[model samples]
Target: MNKLKFFVAALLMIVAGTASAQKTGYISVEQVISLMPETTRIDSLLRKYQSDSLNPQFTYMVQEYNRKDSMVSTKDSVKLSAQVKNQIRQELEGYAYQIQNWQQITQQALQGKQQELLEPIYRKVEAAIQGTAKENGYAYVLNREALIVVPPADDLLPLVAKKLNLKVPAAGAPAAAAAPRR
Candidate 1:
């Protein structure tokens, strides 16, 4: 009976030790990404794409819409031939459709551009995180935002940033506003 009890106690200790040995760490992914110099470059490129490409295209579309609208509104419908009036009306409707969807189109373009510019940077950050975890023997690395109870020691932001050769921001440093929301 004593032997049986001792065996069960040893088994419990082994199980508990194994569970406790698994290292869980957390990283503030957003914080680390913000510190990377490439992020600044990517942000600048996205802004330039928006201002140079999307804005001009949107302005042209708006102008076209306005021109069609003015023709539809100002032209004398009674004196015009049925075919001409119908053609003008069709043109106006097309312009209206384009105008209505313009914002969505621009927004999609912005998001697409952002993703294109950020993918490589994101990959680099991921590699650094992976390397940090592997070197430190972290079995699981959670995003800081997702964690409920995190100790300061378990935060891997500095380690990952170091691996990426970036400086970590001071604890009380104000965060820079990120690029416009998607």
Candidate 2:
């Protein structure tokens, strides 16, 4: 009976020790990315891509649509064959459809451009987070936004930011506000 009791105590102690050794931490990855200097450059590049590439394409599409519309409207329909008129009408409809959906199209283009530009920055931040976790003995790192209540010292933002050579905002400051809107 004494041996049984000793064995049970040993098993409980081992379980407690294993549980205590596992460390978990939390960080706001968006906050870290916002603090990164690369993010500002990415924002600038996206703006430039919009103005330089997307805006001109939109303008050209509108101009082409208007020109086609004007040509169809001014031409004499009585002199034209039914087949020719139908073809022109179909073409005009296509243009109108593109113009109507331009916002969604442009939004998708901008999102793709932003993703391309941000990919490397994301990789860098991920590496820093992984390295920090490994160096600091964190078994799991949770997104800070996912947690309702967290232990103060277990916040890994400062450590991760430091690992990335970025400055963290002072306590009580809204770090999320610095993040760029997607």
Top candidate on TM-score is: 2
* Per-residue lDDT value at 175 in model 2: 65
lDDT of 2 at 87: 87
The total of clashing pairs for model 2 equals 0
lDDT of 1 by residue, 53-168 (tens): 98888788778878756665775556777788789788878767877898898888888988877777788888888889999999899988787888999898889877888877
Candidate 2: list runs displaced more than 4 Å.
Answer: 1-16, 76-81, 173-177
Give model 2 RMSD, 1 decimal.
3.0
**RMSD for each of the candidates:** 3.7, 3.0
Query: Candidate 2: deviation at residue 88, Å?
Result: 2.8
**Residue 168 of model 1: what lDDT?**
70
Q: Candidate 2 on 1-182: residue-level lDDT in tens?
A: 99999999999999999989999999988888889888888888888998999889889888988876776677565677778878878988987888899999989998888888777887888889899999999989999889999999999988988888888878987664465544
Model 2 TM: 0.85
Count of backbone clashes, every candidate in sequence: 0, 0
